[model samples]
Target: MIKLTEINKIYRTNEIETVALENVNLEVEKGEFLSIMGPSGCGKSTLLNIIGLLDAPTSGIIEIGGTRTDGMKDKQLAAFRNKKLGFVFQSFHLINSLNVLDNVELPLLYRKVSAKERRHLAEEVLAKVGLSHRMRHMPTQLSGGQCQRVAIARAIIGNPEIILADEPTGNLDSKMGAEVMELLHQLNKEDGRTIVMVTHNEEQAKQTSRTVRFFDGRQVE
Candidate 1:
């Protein structure tokens, strides 16, 4: 579960101050698939980044699975994030040079896990995402949907409890997008992973367990 109270994210420069999130409060229950819907510049992705602890809120409290993150040091935050959260992005964030198996194993390199164990875990998750046959392929060799699947495999290989996805299907065709959504739904329903996704698709939002709408950095619904 995740909780955010009075969350505000502001970017300030010499003569300009922009509020990305304004006193936004949110709560995501365990095993819930939540969608955040909004137009561009409405802070949907900013909110997601804040919740994922990749960015800090200007003034607010963030609690994930009962642990308060506002006060955690950088090293502590990194360690906690590595263990408790997974991230998926529209851009796929895959290293072009690394093959599927190696990319999926990147997260484990930060931990004390051995190479053999990392490969085993990567293989298992790649299989879960139906990418077992493509493990040796490079990012340039895969389709958009396949790239996303590889990204998903990388995200889950650590078995993180929370998945934060931002515009996960933005770059794919409808068919590919649907396939990715099906995979996400399976992870949410069958694996019981908590997912908080930011999307612009109305139908996709409707499919989630709950949806929250935002406008001008404020949660409107």
Candidate 2:
């Protein structure tokens, strides 16, 4: 459902130029679960950001669900991203002041969904993540695993077609990391959501349907 052709990303400073991605071409089919694994400075996160439309590529094209995103305006890209993508990060990225339910409902709020509908959707996702009872808890009140579960719920609350996770288990213990990975697998296998996860763990990458290795901004076989 996602296609990248000759994707190139460059970072320029007054004295230096850094190439984050070099003519990267890849395709992820609908309902596929793909893991990107690499060492530090491999551009995995940069590629993920490009796929999520959080950053623009210096050249090449990206098509999401068949629409070309390369030439879209910022507002158009933002709207498209909101409607088509969900993100889960290692940091959880939850607002400290917001309760679990409110954090989960935040995406729907941007979509202008009605309050009743957003609450219902958010609550349903929270229940799926076994967080219904903790809906009113703040981020500080939850353990790392619980907080990650809340983040996962928030990511899926909008029913976005693709989930982009960057080092999702980086901050958790092995057990908690496994739990998070299991949840992501369940979403991919049962819910039929496409997932592109960037991680440094070999065992974690092995659990995914397919794994792509990267080195110094280039994909390795």
Candidate 3:
């Protein structure tokens, strides 16, 4: 479903350049749950961002769902991202003022869908995450777990084929983290969603279908 060949990401300043990823090649099959593990500043999140199309690679080929995304303009990339990718962040980037349902419905607002249908889709995904009861509550009113659940709902509401989770369980307590992990598993296994997650927890990484370790911006075999 996703393939990267000879991908490299470099960040440059006036005098120094840092390598965030080096000659990285990876392929994730459809419905596979792949975990990326690395120490801080080792390019785990950078790799995820590149694969998610949030950032473009310096020079490489990125094929997602059989389409090459390398040379697309910004507008085309945005449309492709909306239709093919969903993102879950470590910070659970939800709007503080919007209710759970409204936040989940935000992704659909850009589409040619009606308000009523958006509401229905939002509620459906929230229900999938077992958060239908909190639909009207604001982000401030919810716990960390609830916030992430809301984030997950917002992500999958568009029914994107790939889910990119960057340190998804980083902020929650153990139990809540477990809950979110289980929810992700259900999405991958039952719903046939392709999941690529970056995580520090060894046990959580173990639970995934495969785990790839990184060091100093290179994949370590």
lDDT of 1 by residue, 200-221 (tens): 8979778754555654587646
Q: Lowest lDDT 10-mer window, candidate 3? A: 207-216
What is the lDDT for 198 in model 1? 90
Candidate 3 lDDT score at position 160: 97
Give the per-residue lDDT digits (tens) of candidate 3, residues 76-131.
99999999999999999999988999999999999999999999999899999999
The local distance difference test score of model 2 is: 0.90
lDDT of each: 0.92, 0.90, 0.90
State which candidate has the highest lDDT: 1
Ranking by TM-score: 1, 3, 2
Tens digit of per-residue lDDT, candidate 2, span 19-85: 9899888889999888887888879889999999999999989999999997789999999999999
**Stretches of model 1 off by over 4 angstroms after superposition:** 210-216
TM-score of each: 0.97, 0.96, 0.97
Candidate 2 regions with alpha-carbon error over 4 angstroms: 212-215
